[model samples]
Target: MSDDDAERPLKRHKPQHEHQETNVTEIERSPDFWFDDGNIVLQAGPTQFRVAKSMLSRHSSVFRDMFSLPNPTSESTVEGCPVVVLAGDTNTDWKHLLAVMYPAICYDLTKPNIMTVISVLRLSKKYDLPAFRKESIRRLRGDLPSKLEDFRKLPVAGWLYLGEVSDVQLSRTIALAKELCLWSILPAAFYGLIESIFNHDGSYRPVGLSLADEISLLKGYARLTRLNTEAPNRAWLEAESPCVPCDDCLFRTLCRSRCASLRSTLQAQQAGPGAVFSGWDENWSDEFCGPCIKAAKEAYNDKQLEIWKQLPSFFGLPDWEELRKMDLDAGE
Candidate 1:
């Protein structure tokens, strides 16, 4: 017999009771899953999903190769259908991935739940599904700030929301970013983790962060502290302005107060330098007239951009240009 044929078990004459027991077992189905005219049965852990092999193979090379394997007589079957047991992946993750592949279901790739996006990314990478992997990466990169201007505008609450996603835990996301070589996201992800570690009073509140993560945060925090202290000195607050008179003009005075206020706020909250630029409108009171406020805001925006340029350095990372080049070289 050929090697392929040798792999198959020979038909053996079985007793009536053995045959009956095999038939009964074959007829049994998992309650959680229903057959939908699907040709393949995929079992992950205790859960089983009846899905089409063609649909899966269309998107995943791994699945295509797996299904292409010659079936042996001794292989397990579910109701005479091929049973593909996937022990490595969780049921929830498999279901999430399948939801993205099937045309009958509407899965939003853009604003997918964080865990769903992570699941899709992980499975897609494993199964060599380039399209799904790209979509997942796009979704995750969407959450982060790509431009220097946007970094200052990132919402603090948004970071907390990301932390709340059960499967997309903050620590795990950091590790995954490193594994996937997503260098662009490291600064923001580290910032979010550092921000999450503090209470309103700036007390260190451990939220199940790993030791390595804690060390990285501490190192990043030290750098942020230096940046926050030096940020005001770099502000573009010119002494002379057309909007204010020479001697009695409160423009320079107000500008100084604003810078001091920003520094004080940073110190009080023990926040990263990004915090000084973000959410400022709500906290800023009009201590000066409109012209002065306008001028100050203009200068603040320029200073904020400057600070953003130094964000990677605050986390001991390479500058934007070098990081971008690295990402390009890696084909990311």
Candidate 2:
């Protein structure tokens, strides 16, 4: 950069210039990423992280290209290190990704913190760090898979393997997916979200949920409920081609009785096709007659797969393959 620009004063929410570095009382040094010998400063809003240039350039092609240039804006410095202003990336995300990269030789990416994984994902995508991005996507899809068989492996109510997978968390994931175009996780995320919506005591909206998402959730819920009430998915209810249970079939009696009861009665059934047909209550199925059990399992396999297949559409999304094609992670 021109010496004129190099001498430019620090602007609002930026690190101080080298000549007046002591005036940086306004800037907060990142607790996680600051290093005494670090050669570059990354300004994430008012926070400054003193980190190595070569290290970042190694993982990030963007960083490589960036550091290759004489200097990119911020026109400020901490110590002798030139500060690069990060307009959109948050300090928390930068810290999270940098923490993984620095100080530690190896850290487990499996069962990663959902928020950390998400941050890494965002930063990785922005910075063109393919390894971190790929791993983040892997961790995300491990819990929320595109394939039905993989999703079935999670607990009946536990559609997502991430801790708790609360309504708030699901909404956050959906928001992230929308933000980053992470389409593959949407079908299962929407499926899990519908259960929470159904169980709410009238107030279904979570904070930060966009109007578009709120509408989609409600619409998807309605469609899913309609599907469950129809043949195939709800075939166990025996609305059509009613099954005359054999004398010893206790499940025949329980299933009929449960159908009339509140959703609170059968926790798994409350989720309808997604949970129930994953063979959640295999022992419960054992109570039915041979022919009845066979039919129910068939319905479970066929209808659950069908329900999974339609989950994306219920939320106004394209099919899984098409959704994959829409993602940044697609085709790799």
Candidate 3:
């Protein structure tokens, strides 16, 4: 027999007197839970939900195996339905999960808030619901790029968008990423965390961070500050151009103006290194002489890639390759 068959209970004849004694035990139905067609009652905390067993079993392998097992004779039974008490989960989380499972209700996955998505993700992972889990991951990764090149292209506004989501959500995302060894999402997630923690006057606040997390953010902030300050000091910026120009040449003046403008803008905005590089690309291109622009581009690209590689370390995480391998092993 297969593993499923091994778990199946052997059929046995029970005396009428014993069966009648079992039926005499009364199980109270929840006052608010009244789904006439539902086959099962799930109690989480004080809240009860009368939902279809097939609906849950269809989406979750864990639930399918659980429902397939025979219930103990002494367990609570309401009416003809089985009562499963989910002690570890909260009513709010169950409400959110069921909302997603049944679209006729209030939850809409298309435009889910950070907490809603997180709730779904947590429950889905617990229940072994692969599709729900994947969807939650995708929504959480929304508009955030994983690749170095793509991340470099994202503007300060994009980082702000991710950071502005809620301190609680940012904290949870960081914790979950650490737990799952999801390194690919860490760069953008940490960028959001840094933006949320550091204030405008250069002072830092603890916000939702623990002491260790605070230290990591401060260290990452210092590194980012150094990168932003040193970005314009590349050797090529001062290197002699092949196309010699006068002191008052428009190209020379424009190049200097653009560089200073970007540096000041980045400082004023308290932008991260990635945003600083993106600022250069967006605001400093094509205005300078061809040779000067080419050299500057090469320097910026090299520095940006270097910084990208060190991003995980800035947030006190293992390097990208190590994180990738860790996640891969976790899958097995």
Candidate 4:
């Protein structure tokens, strides 16, 4: 990067390691409105609240209704109150993706104090708030795979996203689950994800394992792959078999069955003595069908007609059939 780019200032709502004063001044002084813990304060406006701790109360309701909020009573407020704040760097790419599914994460928390929701997520576990922790984990994990680029770019957010996933998104999730491990999983974890995805029709079918369970397996497998000294590419278990073995090997058989083009190459090799493996042409595209495209367009127009009818009605309009006839006449 140029020197000019390097000097750009980083901005964030929650200050970084530099701790600033946490004070709540009363716009209209009232004892009941003040929260004793210095971490949060109420801000009032000329005619309304510029901001308020009452915003946190909204987080409290969502915390409660997750259907598992720990304590329901107003007296339970202190323990249930959000106790930590987690913020990602301001320049995150996938914050767009995060915001797309924000409603699910923060429940019904309003716009003013989103950091409160993030803070609740980050510290819920540390403070023994099981319900909030679970909610946070669920939200983070749900968006984990799609936001991998974002996670990797923002190390702090990535670490938190990783910690959230390291236990639940194992090899199985890596393989059969959407391409979550597209970037990388340790080789064994790579194989495991392959096994999971390929073995079960490429859907990460849930087999009653908790998210935590899946992540634990991925972490364990990652550790194992790291310690092994062997090169992943050169380590082929199928190499011991004869070049043209008649032996019934399950691995070889499965590989051959799933890959039709490879089988065709094998047949070509057998037919020509002393032949080397010639790779099949990879340049074929699905043959386009003019009729199918036309049919699809018609179906799409029909669907659009339904959507247009549902919208506010025009006082007078030509029927669709009449519009088509007009087009035909115009062409003629």
Candidate 5:
């Protein structure tokens, strides 16, 4: 075989819905190393060691955390040690630079560790450190349906970004990811969400829930008070459930959309009778607010049965043709 052909690895066949495999080992052991004066030193082979540190304090927290430590002593064991030796590559300076740089780029000190992991995931893939890469991938996949939206916004900076993935695979994996995680990725997430809702499942192509469905569910909950007289006061908004709860809330914009009336109410306090536009960008509503729902419903209505005429054909949902045939048979 040619050198190029020889270097090409065999493609592993994957089963549908099978989660991608990652290589990770439990952190049962650690590395023996020392950090001093913004530099890291580690023993390599006999008679030699490696060292690295951040070029700047703002560059990486990993280096800062490591540098604050003293060298490992003779009494120290691998357990509870925080350092990891990168396998294969032997340049200590480069390794030190990575230790310092990776953390700086991936982590925002103010955010939780989970958020930091999202940024480090691709970096893990780059170093080809099987354990780190595997663990990072698993963390992301395990968080799955919860991290779906977050996955969308994540820098597609690693092996996963390569075009080897299929539409079916991406759709299936993402359909099950976290909505908030998926929301972070925006257009990519939007397309993936759409694909997931329209995926085929062998003999029975399933119809998955769309963004519209989620909005409809929210609206249904909001309208519940009007339906049942004795139903406990089920206000959608409450002191417990404010307009925006978390920093990554999926419905923050939808729930707290700008109101003309609220603007007018505030304007009443101003000296001039002239009104200031609600200052709410219409795009926000078109993209994430309730108006999108209204617009989609209107468009769908305009398309009539033509759009849905194939819904049954594509997804086997109540098969309109089969239903008509059944009716004809009954008439006979």
Candidate 6:
């Protein structure tokens, strides 16, 4: 995507499935978050939750303000309680929010439920529920952590648990992060998407992302591929570096034999920025001379670290510190 592509029309939004139309006389009750003695009815889509207004007002300033507004003398009621049909929200979104907020059946955030995190995050933002929003962001950061060390611990498919998320959902995560101004997660999110493409065959299209984001990913992917191609394989893209000074008679051959032997493995192992080269074995050091061993361990890892540090810039994002600062300022 480019600035000039602003006029380029994208495919029309085609939903996989439409929301089931509920009959006016057949509104369904929520299995959870439905209090029998509740004084308010919150409906979204087809589902309705009877809940205590005091509790909602206590947690959400938006809700408090909305409730404090003067109601019409002829306001409609459901079961004698005021009905607040929240527009532009899905039943799932309301369900997740209420599940997390409800005292008796508080939803556990420890579970790896990205849907819960996302849904709660959206409603929490809209309702100004600071605590829930903060916790939801924490959960998102846990999955797409900023640190390279933490990032390496994730699986080969690059993000999400087995069968827990698909590439389409991951793409949606990118869109959500951008929309919410959660800039800190962008680097790792993009890296995860690209890494999945190379190593896991993940195929992401510009479904919900903007043209700028699409362009950013394309350029970043090209740059990452170049980096991966040159990564520590042939003396790390600096075969005759004056820094190493391995041209001496003793250091002659530059241990090229040992370094060359490992090129195929190194090339195959490296996917992009977070490439930890887990394929490397310490036992392989026996094949290297002293200087060559240092180069192998230190120089190679330094390159990957460099890539990790550049992750944000690769996607036209501010560096990690600036992005982190933005997130902090937003919270404030």
Error of 1 at 273 (Å): 6.0
Model 5 spans with C-alpha error above 4 angstroms:
1-51, 55-58, 75-332
185-210 per-residue lDDT for model 1 (tens digits): 77777776666665444556665656
Candidates' C-alpha lDDT: 0.60, 0.69, 0.62, 0.30, 0.32, 0.66
Residue-by-residue lDDT tens digits, candidate 6, 1-332: 23332222111121222233234576798988778899887878778888998999998887787778776555556666666777667899888788767745356334546776788887777667889888788768867877777666766553443226655566677888866778888887777666555443324455455677778887887777666566544444254662243433245455665455555565566355434333345786676666666656666667666767887998999998888877732547
Off by over 4 Å in 3: 1-34, 105-109, 142-145, 152-164, 181-183, 232-274, 328-332
Worst 10 residues of 3 by lDDT: 9-18
Question: Can you give the lDDT of residue 276 in candidate 2?
Answer: 34
Ten-residue region with minimum lDDT total, candidate 2:
4-13
Rank by TM-score (best first):
2, 6, 3, 1, 5, 4
1-332: candidate 4 lDDT, tens digit per residue: 23442232111123322222223342232233333443232222211111223333444443233324442232212212322221221212123212322334556543322233344443332223455545543443333322223322433222333233332245333332222112212222333332333221223444444465455444433332332222111121123432221233334454333334433443343221101111112221121133322332333334333423321112122333343333211232
Clashing pairs in 6: none
lDDT of 5 by residue, 1-332 (tens): 23442232111122222122211342221132333332323322221222344442244444345456664443222222223343332343333434534454555433223333433433333333344544444544433322223433433322233323333434333333232122222223223333333222212133344555445323332232122221111112223442222344456544355333333333344221001101123343343345433443333233323322333322222344443333211232
Worst-scoring 10-residue span by lDDT in model 5 = 271-280
Residues 1-332, candidate 2, lDDT per residue (tens digit)?
A: 23443333122334455677634667788877889989988877678889899998899887787678666466566677777777656778887888778746565434456787788888887778999888888878888889988876767554343545667777888999977889999877877776665553334556457889888887887776666545353555454444424334556676555443422344344345333334546664545566666666665577677777777898899999999899876767
What lDDT is reached at residue 263 by model 2?
27
| Highest-lDDT candidate | 2
TM-score of each: 0.71, 0.78, 0.73, 0.22, 0.23, 0.74
- Give the C-alpha miss distance for residue 329 in model 2, angstroms: 2.5
Q: Please give the clash total of every predicted structure, in order.
A: 0, 0, 0, 8, 16, 0
The local distance difference test score of model 6 is 0.66
In the order shown, what is each candidate's alpha-carbon RMSD?
Answer: 7.3, 6.1, 7.0, 22.6, 21.5, 8.2
Q: Report the error of model 6 at residue 49, Å.
A: 1.5
Kindly report which residue stretches of model 1 are placed more than 4 angstroms away from their true locations once superposed: 1-34, 102-110, 152-156, 159-168, 229-274, 279-285, 288-295, 322-332
